[model samples]
Target: MFNPSPKQFKFIKALLFVLALLPAVRLLVFGFTDRLGANPIEFITRSSGDWTLYFLCITLVVTPLRRFTNWNWLIKLRRMIGLFAFFYGSLHFTTFLWFDHFFDIAEMLKDVVKRPFITVGFIAFVMLLPLALTSTNGMIRRLGGKRWQWLHRSVYAVAMLGILHFWWMRAGKHNFEKPILFGTIVAALLLIRVYFAWRNRGDGAAKSRTAVQKRQVTPTLT
Candidate 1:
């Protein structure tokens, strides 16, 4: 209903691209202005991680929004929004590696093993890596539609892992509010997809039964 022309769609996409980067730009501005507060590294880490989760939520919402609203153009925007999720996730990871461990792989590995939250976050990031790498059109062609779709479905797991990582991280400090809210949103989004899938499967089975009944009736009538 609110469809845009090709040129307008491109402009809208470009605008979304700029808007996605605003969080990162804000972080840089804050750093330069010394507004990151007493614990700058921790502040940067938390802020970037929060934005990563926010983008993930937004990316997950796109499909459901498109289905309910019939905005087919939203699919075109999904790739960019998903990539932004990876971007913020990478930034969050970089903050840990650069500021927290100073690029010490051994120490990072040790911490990843030692901390449950870090382990979950590490696995989530590792899973996100392949998704980002195979997001190109060429890769999609190479992987084939079914396989590519199967691979991308892992985003559901990534979303769950992200929530678990955040929950565990906050467990120590007893800060459960934000994590609970995010987890609920992610859970609801996943459930919507699951419900549609289940309903479609039922519909397919019902149609098969009707076809069988029609065949039997035709033979008896004959």
Candidate 2:
């Protein structure tokens, strides 16, 4: 009932694409202007990692928001936002791999082994690749709707890994503020998802029992 026309939806999507890139663009501008603070590499790494989590949190809440508001149009933007999460995540990993390790495979592997935060961060990025690859309609068709949905549910795992990564990274610096806040948001989103899933399952079970009860009574009436 509140659907936008094709043209309007296209425009909305175009606007969202630009909005999604604004963070990266801002980071780039800051880098060019030398506004990324004393340690530019650390600044860039933190900023990119922050944005990836921000996008992941935003993407996770989309469904809960849609459910509460009944605004189906919100879903149209979910894919775009999820991809941006992966985009920022890629940048974050590249910053670590290229700038931090200078493409040293052995060094990167050793760092992953030595650093708990980096290990989880690496795992999260690896999880994102499959989701990004399977995001297209073609891939969805190939995987079938149910399978696609199941695979994409891995986003929850990615988000949890992201939170763990952030928490451990911040713990080293004694900075738990942002980590706790984002963790709360992610927890809320996940709880909302579980609540709905359980509610729907209960509703389905209730319907089945009602149908069976009616069938049992029908023969007596005959």
Candidate 3:
């Protein structure tokens, strides 16, 4: 019932687009100016990848937010947010492949097999590719609503894999703080979804009971 004006929708899109670009802009400036401290490549790659996971988590939160807030307009931004997540994620993957591996296919393959963190991260990126490819309106129509919904549920798995990747990557340095924070945010978002789902089921049951009671109480005309 709460529909946003066309202007409001456009503004929202623009704002999110700008916000999504800010990180990349910062990274580019840092790279060009030689501003990355210590390990520049690692800093850029991790920062980009972290933002990608952040966006992915935020995109996942949109559904539950819409339902809980009853602000249906939020649905309009989910696709945009999701695609941005993929964009950042692609950049993250590319940075690692190009900067770290230097396009060495053999070394990259060996690293994936040897490092668990890389393995999970690679798999998460692979999962995101199909989702990004199908983000268009045409793909939605072709896949149909139900099938598309099913396919996109892969984001849940992607999120878990991403967190695991982050966690394991940090484990090497014995720095659990950042990964724990990310895991906490993701877990909180997921718990919100679970709570709302249970609440909706209860509301549905109550509505059904009320309808049945009303039917029983009504007198037949004949």
Across 1-222, the per-residue lDDT of candidate 1 in tens digits comes to 899899999899999999999988998999999998999989989988998899999988987897799886787788888899999999999999998899999999999999989999999999999999988877777876557777888988998899899999899899999999999999999999888666655787887566445423321110
- Cα displacement (angstroms), candidate 1, residue 215, comes to 30
> Candidate 1, clashing residue pairs?
none
Clashes of each: 0, 0, 0
Over the stretch 99-217, how does candidate 3's per-residue lDDT look in tens digits? 88899989998999998999999999999999999877777778766577778879888998999999998887999997888788778888886685566557778885664453232
lDDT of each: 0.86, 0.86, 0.82
Off-target runs (Cα >4 Å) in candidate 2 are 205-222
| Candidate 3, superposed: residue stretches over 4 Å from native | 1-3, 203-222
How well does each candidate superpose onto the true structure, as a TM-score?
0.91, 0.89, 0.86
Question: Which pairs, if any, clash in model 2?
Answer: none
Candidate 2 residue lDDT tens string, 116-194: 8889999999999999998787777687666777788899999999999999988878999998998899989999988
C-alpha displacement of 180 in model 1, angstroms? 0.6
Candidates' RMSD to native: 8.2, 8.0, 7.9
Give the local distance difference test score of model 1.
0.86
Q: What is the lDDT of residue 68 in candidate 1?
A: 93
